[model samples]
Target chain A: MSDVRLSNGSPTLERTDPRLPEHPKPSACKSLFGPVDHEELKKDFNAHLRELEEAAAARWDFDFANDQPLANGRLQWELVEHSSVPDFYSRPPRENGVCSGNNNVDHNGNHHCDGMAQSEETSRADSQMECTEQSSGPRKRSACHDPSAQSKRSHTSPEEVSCPNLSHSAEHTPRKTRRLSALQCVQ
Target chain B: MEDQLLCCEVDSIRRAYQDVNLLNDRVLHTMLKAEENYLPSPNYFKCVQREIVPKMRKILATWMLEVCEEQKCEEEVFPLAMNYLDRFLSVEATRKTRLQLLGATCMFLASKMKETVPLTAEKLCIYTDNSVQPGELLQMELLVLNKLKWDLASVTPHDFIEHFLSKLKICPSTKQILRKHAQTFVALCATDVNFIASPPSMVAAGSVVAAVQGLYLKSQDVSLSSQNLTNFLSQVIRSDPDCLRSCQEQIESLLESSLRQAQQHGGPAESKRVDEEVDLSCTPTDVRDINI
Candidate 1:
């Protein structure tokens, strides 16, 4: 086992096998890249070698299992934790008026608040129409056409914008026949 | 004293072999995801309308190989550097003038990852004949790190060599020879772009099969026939035999062509002249335009 030699004679591996071949002198192939100042390269290489030695020595004292710096004051390992969502998602929503209540954020921070608000408004209209049948549909239809409806639409636009059938029910039902006709129309 | 040292070495090797399962799990988890993270687009250089053709890449790889050989870098460094180069090229439309600088920077980064003693920025800059500054190399290093998403733990064919080799029932001497040949084959694969599509494990298995077959051919040994070696490698690497066979064939063809080219070049001196001529022809005009 001791007599075995690797062809290139890697230093670290050679340390384990004393019988490995002697390190070849730096060869002329070094010139292949270009005219390198050998003295400067040797200096740089030696500095790098010392740094590696220090790092290796530090590694021996470092505690990998606990991932903590040991008494030697060396970093054992660096752990990088990646977030599934982008940075913006992890941040608190902006306090601006445009996206005030829209907290349902996708990974990219696109708000789902508009959809939520629409659904809530539609349910509100449904209950309102159930309470006062005759006046609600006509008022809602008028609201859809009214310029002021834009502001009110945030709260009531589901009936005005989405449910056009409510308008038809209001026109068809007589005041006395409102409840029965409304139910029939809904069915 | 020698016997005692040998005993300790054997014990360490045994312990390492015992921990292979843990090592494999960690390597698979990190490397597979890292592979997914930074794949080079197949035709990005062309899509970007860049002047970097396959011929230029081949020349660059050859130069990188020379640097690694001269420096006596680990087997993993050159391939890993090439991975960085390809991934960076896929994402960034690099100027032709900066290609060698990019190569040097990739080598620097890969050495940091794989070698005990990494090549310093100063040395790398010197390798470029001061055409690139150390500051510039450091900047490019950061750019590469960002583009790779800071995931440097790549799984090259070298990673799978030991696992594949351990499964073979050959004698110790034959195993060592096979490992050397397999290493050479892996380095050869890194120099060509065609092998880029193959997964690292497939490349490893293929190279081992090719190495064994190569050795067997030289010796005219019936035991090293393609069929037996293919079955053995596929079983060891836990890949489909068909895929492994195809990859092995590709490697064999690569080896043949490279050998033919080496012969055609006549010798190293002539080939060096050809490389220098290519470098001189490409750099001056490109560098001037980039500067302006």
Candidate 2:
């Protein structure tokens, strides 16, 4: 596990890093409600929602504040973004990074950064604006100097890398259509 | 004109099915592997060593299910919520009193992830009879998210159902029925802690197989041979035959006992009695002791 921390510490983790599979997007597909009478259901659902909203509003009047301290000492509502944390839990050493290193050696020889380069190209195309800034000058020189460091840089930019795979799969019409059919069948 | 449109729709569905078949295998594999880290320790409730028990979890899961059903929330919401609850209990030594609060908070988080219109924090508090405040639920939500390292996309058995069903060569009519029954089995699996031992894909395959068998037993023309089912499931899930069979057996046994219980005590009324019986002995405690 400590080894995972060391490996993920590298700056080059790309979208295609097999270790870090993209977050499973919440499936948009709806459940099969069976032979539900829509008119009856809509009426019931509306009444239920209205009742719930009323009850909730009543609770909100007196119980608005959480007992837990929000942000140090002050009581303020806040949204914390967790995108900065590279997903370290999922990356077992055998599946990605170090293992890919051996594959790099076996497939592309000493230019081990070849696999990283391919993924980086995809990432570059995927996030052109971000890649343009990061892929130029010092970073590229440093990447050339050390293959391991290059892998690190590629692995670290998960947002740039992971987003494309999700969008790519969704944009791919066949998968999208099948998801639609599956959703329809469920209904 | 109708026939041409039908043919085009079938062609599109078939093409999409093929694409998903390829993608589902890779995705399921990655998810199963990643889930190992997120699973709460099996003895998490035991380790907490208070009023918490395995039965309490069952009761809480039932309540969570009812809440989801009442809201018409997505099928994934309840199971995903259970995952959060178990993961939280594993790490935190929670008081028995806060179990429902934990369950509600988990549901709140999961509905946000899986539903089009999530259950509001205020609404979840109302479900708890106003014992908990919205702010507290929100606080617990953040605590759980942080504890889980913001990995809310943990795979549930539902993710694998469509993939497995597509692999089977069944008639279109029965496919809908089979999918529905399979979903019920998945929900059943979520209520029991034992199912956690099996990977989500295996549970899904098992549920589909069991649903087919259950449906077939009622009438005989389904054409679903065990050998064919086993071969297809093994290939698609990339699992050993023995593991799949064991999981199938577990699900079958769970179904049998549940069926027997329902028959003996007349269903929902009895389950409600059991829940009331369990709740009778509880003493309320401050939420601070929840130890998130």
Candidate 3:
């Protein structure tokens, strides 16, 4: 009773044996199918990663819609009747709005929605690639560089297209990232 | 010897299964950790939820699409704003402060986190119309973060809406509406801030389904074969029909305003202008759809 100690220099309740209670350890690599072929899945996973990267780079941003900062917390009817509803965003731009002539906001001090800053473009590209790779059909094609498909896809999904952990192996994304996905895209 | 004994006591306190704050209290701290299953103190919740809904409605109403139509704030910034608000109010600070200042601090913290090129203190002052001070906002941000243990990770209604949409094998058009509904619904939840304790995804799914139901789109019936999908969606929308109706009223008003603004600013000639823009980029296959 006088000589009990825990790890980290913390004291432990005195017992006959001070050694840490032993328990069965978990398997180092648990797979859906016992003893999974890591080599096969690894290659497949890598291909998916590359496809996502390429798709992201090729994605575009063409939304010309301008939404004012929400007054209070909701939209006002008066402003809605007077202002044009913004078109949704498209893909990453070749240039930022500051560099593009579209940077000129309306007389009403509206911020430019067409031109995404570089960092946003980068994140969008990353999200785009990830989104395309996650999908299985025609939408999966990287249409960012293909201006023809860009417009068609614009009516599809906006930034919500690039959700984290959307793939079969989505579970592999870090827990931290998955948790952040909870916030979605408010900020 | 005294230092060693003190260290042991501190270690024991840290190792205690129950919270240390539970000792000697009329109200238990355990109750503090209790699920905010109910709304916050009705007074504060009502203040933001009731006032902000109409205000957001006004903003949504007047927005438009244009060649040079400026982007409002980035979508990325919105979550941060919501997070700032949520984290700020999660504490017991409401006992000490008022709602207006709390709401202002949330905006300040969120603007800094979300905006790529954030607004300045002066701009924020103008934005909130001098409701709060930059110094106070900054101080509040730090205080809120500390209260939240700097755990900034948040799940928004948008994220849940996205996941819920993906669960269905729906068309892209439907998906788009779902996306809109999700955003709108999340914004709607802000009006009923008592639901803040619920995950954003759950709130988004719940609100979207409710919005869909209100719009006469029986999303639950969309997947009739999948009872799981139907039941899951049904539960979410069923909780508060009245809140859903109120949200729908807000959205309809906003949409009307947005369309009106588009018409006034966009003009009759705008249709042709957008058509030409669309024609310039639309592919050969899409040509038929464009005409139709």
TM-score of each: 0.53, 0.53, 0.35
lDDT of 1 at B270: 69
Residues B1-292, candidate 1: write the lDDT tens digits: 9888877656432111123463354554455455555456667657752768877777778878766665667777888898888888887776676777789889988877765346667666656656666655664564566556556767777777766666666776667667766777888888888875567777888988887766654244544678877876676555678988999899888877765565566576666523423332233234334334
Off by over 4 Å in 2: A1-187, B1-24, B48-50, B217-223, B267-292
lDDT of 2 by residue, A22-57 (tens): 221122111111122335433543453344334422
List, residue by residue over A37-104, the lDDT tens digit for candidate 3. Answer: 33553354345334433442233332112111122421111111101211112222334321123332
Which ranges of candidate 1 are over 4 A from the true structure?
A: A1-187, B1-38, B217-224, B235-239, B271-292
lDDT of 3 at B95: 26
Instruction: Using TM-score, rank the candidates from best to worst.
Output: 1, 2, 3
Q: What is the C-alpha lDDT of each candidate?
A: 0.54, 0.51, 0.36
What is the TM-score of each candidate's chain B when compared with the real chain B?
0.79, 0.79, 0.51
Interface RMSD (Cα, Å) for model 1: 15.8
Candidate 1, CAPRI quality class derived from DockQ:
incorrect
| Maximum-DockQ candidate | 2
Model 2's interface RMSD: 20.6
Better of 1 and 2 by DockQ: 2
DockQ score for candidate 1: 0.02
* Residue A77 shift from truth in candidate 3, angstroms: 60
Error of 2 at B54 (Å): 0.3
